[model samples]
Target: MNESKFFWQACRLLWMSGILLVLISWGSDVPVSTAVSNISYATTITVDSSRDVSTSLSERCDTHTPCTLRRAIVQARLLAPAARPVLIQFDIPTSDVGYDASQELWELEVKSTTDPAVFRTVEGGQVTIDGTTQPHGRVDGPKIILVGPATGNKNGLIIGVNASGSHDNNIVRGLGFQNFKDHLTINSSHNTIEDNWFGLTSEGQQPYLRNDNPQDGSGSAGVVLISGAEQNLVQQNTFLAFDGVAIALRGNDNTVRHNQIGTNALGLLTLKQTSPSLLCTPEDWLGGGGISADGTGHLIEENIIAGLRQQIFAISTQPDAIWVQSTCTSCTIQNNQVGVDAEGHEVGVCGRGFYLTNTKQVQVIDNVLAETYHSALFLNGALYDANTLRGNIIRKSTPWLIPDDSPKGDDAILRFTGLPDPLEFFNPAKITHIEGTTVSGTAGDGSPCPNCVIELFLDDNDNINEALESVAVVTAKADGTWSATLPTPLADGFGLRTSSTTAQFNTIANISAGTTVGLSELYMPGYVGYLPLITR
Candidate 1:
């Protein structure tokens, strides 16, 4: 063929590929320019009153008139199909309607269960409800609060109207949610919940004092992503002192990062109770922990979870800091500070750091856990296989087997079931010598690991891998011996550790005991205290 004819054919193929990509984006409900129109005018709505009144169909949102939050939501939902990506901002003054003078706060109570305080995105439309525009808000937190009803299981803000709707690409930010069964529930995908405070006052210094007279016994949750909700981001929020889990994540492919669970806003203090009368009853079923996750491809990272336990409740069992259910797979938990405060102080949790059962291909890496009353890592039985635990630091974890085990703190860090030879399955990399960046190690003990991958790290004196710098990676010989030369000379006064990954199942093991450069060493166990990696 001629050169001009060939170039014309190539251009045709490129145009066809672009059409196919647009179709795929629409099938996944992605907001491309073709799928969703950018309505610049008449897309911004403002709420000047804190009243919880419904709006009529004829009276849509007008920027000049006074509107309530519920009215703003109704107006946004009633927009034409062409108008989308609406922004609902607040401009309520101190003397606005529904503002309490004695309490000095603006509270929007849910008026009805049928039309609750919710943000339901229309199909192919997106919405953002921002409370940062409130005049009385603090510099760091929100000033407007959403309160639930007195006697029912009401949610503060729901992303989808129902399970049947594909309400996607909505955002709720810079708000305070309290006194609801669930502060927020997302039944849609591609939503973002950031910079919000759950179970706390707008100032983020105290819990919201509820006015429930009889004290509704329904448990509370910070944020809940229901099943089939995928690709959502829950970040930079404070979840404190709820009766149930801080984040009940039942979605797939979601990312929950940089949120404070079971702690104060700054993570410098432990969480306090939301109300003195709100207690967990014997029949409550959802009080799991900081994060109760049950789906695949989830990432829970960089959160501080501590002080989550009920002191006066009929069900006295405390919750795990992070619980991955049996059905989950390919989830990653990394860079989280569990069972401790942000300052590395021992603000202990009543349960284990991680409670994993029958999970497959889960990675728990580079987490620092301290002062857990139960074992730091708990695998229920032999059915839990093909999971990886690499570069974790645990201190002051106790053995908790039964209901009343008499609380021996910091005694054990691991509890795995039915491992006859624990070392064969859980062998840490052993560094025998390190001379001028060439580090040598025994990567295996027996048949559990062969031709393993040894990963070396340079942590700054602390045992934990804080900077996530992997200095070197080398493969072990079939005989279980390995050696790797780094790119640069090993620095003085810096600590080093190695983590081993087995060749057969690709399972990553815990990091070896740290070794200081140029220092002679006795044999150091992988775990610092009483227990080994697993117990029979």
Candidate 2:
């Protein structure tokens, strides 16, 4: 058959199949026949529901006006996965305002309602659930997108991997989620989950609400990617204030980069059901937390973990801000920080920095750890052949101090040669400029960290941990005012981070945008703590 005849035959076949299709030329603006089976199209579904099916909306809902999130997802799945497939956009009219004061956000609260009523499932392979269409990203405005069940046992959003993507190729971006047990269960690969707030506020800075229950349920996890979730990018999202771990990565070969990880009982967790019996939350959580990477060949780089202090017996317990355990052999954790208050006062506990248990050949490089009860990094009985640990900075109180007095060394790095190898050069570089630097700042709550040390670092291309040295270190006064007069060096940029010893909160600020020689009052605005200058 000639090309013209083939085209007409294709068109006739698609029309007979009765599938709604729109075909456009791949290279030009010429109109193509989507009625042909060779042509695939795109569908856009708009949601306007503030309530889940359990409340007021219809489940198994159509892809028409007054749509719900569940309906949009379900309708999108109807069209067989295609190259240019469906898009689920939002025009959600929310009743509640968000952290910002000028924006009106969209909210989806799921509760006591699942299946039958609305056939609650968001099934898709080539679908994009974009929440950016609404108002978002303002300190006191409304959340542009919010999805969570208010009162029921509804699991948030369960997504299956795409048919043809390298790793989570599906897109779940620019949205806010809360309340439901687990926010997202991404079974896809090669997808991008960027600019979203999971278990956090619309601004991705503070926790929308703190759901801390050590009792009834497993609490909630922001995102849970099961096995086979390879090469996916989970970045720039806020995993904060959940009852359980923030991110649980059961997959392998993934990259989690440049995200603001907030305080929860457990921040990030990675594990396998197979080998050496990993110790997670139920095991007293002393093994590791904040960011747990226990998968093979994973990269967790340049992330900030703040306000993640777990309470024990009414006092804050020392937990690993980053846990590298299980059989996560050959994983790299670099330039991550704990005990960071974004260059401000202490609001977070800044618990134990890094914990490495039963693992081999894990590399931990260029991290800043401060204000911990026990030690910065801990290693257990599992170091055999070759492992590299270096370029880490640590500041902490004596283990024999009032609250943390456990007779443990208040040392910078706690090594179990059976595990950790903090080489002499990689040992904690003094964050304290005891003689020559002036540092002053208040807490996130407008107070000062009493008797805390201030450290100033030279910012080399924005990396202040291993790339820069401590230019100044000073102790804070009773009123939180701290200063040290030292000769200033001319450098490209500078990083200043401060934390209190007695107080659990922390913050950071950078002098990169300051005068050559002037007072830089850092500001970290949030509840727990931040590193506007951990500057990470």
Candidate 3:
């Protein structure tokens, strides 16, 4: 009996051991699936100075090592390549903690050596980098996104994404890039920058970099540098107090529309390079203007540019504004309004309505210039043939002198050759006379004279001869007065000749040198017929 009981106990122990081994195997396999699932996964990276870095908020935070935000970004880029839509949230104190106006939070260097196909999505972070990071170098990249905080103190987030032949197909949305030094240079193709607040202060330095040195003066510009980028879209941005241009574009086949660019030294400036020698100068640079396109086959339309000291200066600023040097061809500046001030004086100095220089095959149409200090359209240098200026409303105002030249008011329409006066042929005061005249005869008394015969003659060949066929008849009234309403003839030549007579007069009196007698009816004798004159 004892041996049988012992056998039962041994069997029970073996079963229990088998169950424990099964649990151990299951635990070992579960970890492998968990590690594999994390590959190419979407993750959130949050940066806060107060939180302990070692805390395992997620699987990403494994250690407590102190790392810079810029380093964290580099790691994220290396770790995740296929996983899309990664968000980086920045929780920095506005007034006290990590908010250092003197120092930069992040600086991204884009150069030609960088890969153009790597796509990165960056959001909700601040970056500060000066020219010293890599002085005199260009930053290039493709597809970088920058996002800002939703609700916090208005500390003015600053970020610089300067690229040269790099940033193609990238998007920058929802941030206040204030006091950014140097130009937010972009020389890439197919990039979009929209929905950001940009503030400017001076004419030569960026606003964000201006705080670095009190003496190293640079202009505050919203978006200054652009060259050789194609099909870029810059829309829905606010540029305030910028000394340089709000948006300076120098690429082909780009669209800049629907942006509120104001309160700058100069609004928008565009450039194109013929030989690449006639680009903008250091002194000619102003802080205001909105969206100037200086490359061939580009479009600048439907943008609100106001309160600028200088509105739109499209001169040969180094690279040029449309066509480089003298080869700007096939560009269009249409449907834009300038010179409407939101505040300040009714008239502002250092302002230009729209300046065009050395361009061809361009069209400027459907623009309204109201209360400006200079001419609505200033065409300088050599404007080529086949260019058009139509449907523009220029409001009338007193002349304001810009340096040596006095620009006509908003309503002034000017077309000049060389340095001659533009108003010689386009005189606004000249009255245009219509087609025929009226004649009345008086009776021996001072009463009305009816039944008067009147002769009509063509003044010049410039008049519409075809129009005379429909309404070219006149009859004397009861008071010896007659009136005629001339009709224009149609191209088909099927219309009536006159009301009074079917006979057409081929020749009439020559009134230029007064009246002369003994003149034959100037006609091709047998070609057409006319009524013989019956003298009263």
Best TM-score goes to which candidate? 1
User: Where does candidate 3 have its weakest 10-residue lDDT segment?
Assistant: 510-519
Cα distance off (Å), candidate 1, residue 268: 2.9
Tens-place lDDT per residue, model 3, 40-78, is 326444533322233122223223344333433443443
Poorest 10 consecutive residues by lDDT, candidate 2? 510-519
Answer with 1 or 2, whichever has the higher lDDT. 1
| Candidate 1 backbone collisions, by pair | none
Residue 189, candidate 1: how far off, in angstroms? 0.8
Work out the TM-score per prediction.
0.71, 0.59, 0.47
In order, candidate lDDTs are 0.60, 0.48, 0.36
Backbone clashes in each candidate structure, one number apiece?
A: 0, 53, 61
The reply for model 1, stretches above 4 Å from the true place, is 1-42, 53-66, 100-105, 112-124, 162-165, 209-219, 270-288, 311-316, 397-415, 418-448, 454-475, 483-500, 506-536
Better of 1 and 2 by TM-score: 1
Which lDDT tens digits does candidate 1 get at residues 1-536? 12222332332243223221121221223223211233354478888877756534334456435587766776777767567777888888887766766555677765654554343333334777877656654454555777666643666777765444447777787677867777788888878787678877555554453453122222368888888888788876778766668899987988886677766555555333323233233222122358998999998876778766543454455788999887678898877877665555566676677887767688887787766656677655454556666666655522334434432222223334332234224654667666675677775344334576676756443322222345676777877788888777656546455656556633333322221111111122232221122122
After the best TM-score superposition of candidate 3, give how far the Cα of residue 533 lies from its true spot, in angstroms: 42
